[model samples]
Target: MTGSIDRFDEVVDEAWGRAFRGRPLADRVFYLASELGDFSVLWLIIAAAQGLRSDADADESIRLSLLLLAESILVNQGIKRLVRRPRPAATEPRPHHVRQPGTSSFPSGHASSALAAAGIMSHRHPRAAPLYYGLAAVVATSRIHVKVHHASDVVVGAAIGIGFARLAARVWPPPGER
Candidate 1:
């Protein structure tokens, strides 16, 4: 069973490789899917929502948005500090991807942010839950597709994100109409 699972993981990785495989250019762009795990996407989403705030929903939006952002930072930073696991490329003899400058690479920030966004959006706004989670899946797959993180790393990071977001929501409930 373990061997089969590992083989499946490699097969999935290979399928992705074939789908996006190309010159270094193609590899580089496909590699960018890993970027989705970074904090930039979270900031962009927050900024866009903030920009479209209305007179009534403005307060609510700001409150939830701030909470989400804070939670993301806390979870991402805390896990990295705690795990400090090295990137696969650094340790493995035949790493899937190139080495990055970061010291550790246990839980991907990109995965964390994606998971947090998915969780918060899913709970705070049920209508957008599917979309947020769908996007999160894509980003998570991209990290593995790019070979920057392992399947387990993405999984754990996402779990952390969702957990943190849930905790934040309880700690700071969204604003209700007064």
Candidate 2:
């Protein structure tokens, strides 16, 4: 089973290898995704702006987002330490502006953050669930796109994120709901 999983990881990494090589547009999209998903920056910025303007639901969104992010961070770090899988080896010069993270690559922190934010936001704004999860998917795939993580890593990171989000939500529910 371990060998099969390793082979699958290798195969998927190889399949997406070209995108990190010379394809200009793919490189740009993945780079943007990585940046957008980093520490859940894009979502936090949007939530902050909305909160500053006193928009309805902004406070709850921000609170839930924070909770989800914190929990996901714990999960990501713990899982990474436990798994300790190395990232895929880059064959040649990576595309311009590709950043490599210096952490265990078994569970992608970016993917975990993205999914946690998306899971909480989906409940916060049901109408926007699709967009939230869509961005989460992009973020998860971005980890693989840059060859900083394998497919299984992002998938499990997503699960960890979602699980933590649900648990956090139960502990610190939104106002007027608990």
Candidate 3:
């Protein structure tokens, strides 16, 4: 299994190199996909800031909001700093996207933050978990599809985010004594 994964990585890297060669369209697509992930973080912050707005479960919403907020900060900053992986544009030949000045690519911070929100919301709202994770999957794959990150980066970031969200939920269950 491990060997297969290693081979997969090699194949992906090689394909990325070929696909990205002087391809402006690919670069633009990658850039757009990378920026799109940021929108989820924006939405989460907006929803949390706005609060529940008259829902009977306003208090529950606040508690979950706080959990997600903390998870976002911790997962994004911690994983980015700890892993410090370089972006594909930095190393991979003819990387498709424009490289951000200081964004390290190992375990994509965008993927981590998105997964943290998606995982927590999905777990808290089981019926909607599938949809949430499905969206998260799109966000994760976007990273690779753009060629800014390797498949491994997306996978690890997702694991870290999901693990962190679960831990946060466990340590700080929602209000109303659930």
> Per model, how many backbone clashes are there?
2, 0, 1
Better of 2 and 3 by lDDT: 2
Give a tens-digit lDDT track for model 1, residues 9-98: 567667766776555665564455455346545435553575486653566556656765676566556767787766644232322354
Candidate 2 residue lDDT tens string, 128-167? 9899899888888988887788888888888877887687
lDDT for model 1: 0.63
Cα-based lDDT at residue 159, candidate 1 = 84
Of 1 and 2, the candidate ranking higher by lDDT: 2
The models' CA-based lDDT, in order, is 0.63, 0.76, 0.65
1 versus 2: better TM-score goes to: 2
Pairs with steric clashes in candidate 3: 85-106
Worst 10 residues of 1 by lDDT: 90-99
TM-score of 2: 0.87
Quality of model 3 by C-alpha lDDT: 0.65
lDDT digits (tens) for residues 98-117 of candidate 3:
43526567676667767777
Ranking by lDDT: 2, 3, 1
User: For each candidate, what TM-score against the reference?
Assistant: 0.70, 0.87, 0.68
Q: What is the lDDT of residue 103 in candidate 2?
A: 73
Off by over 4 Å in 2: 18-21, 53-56
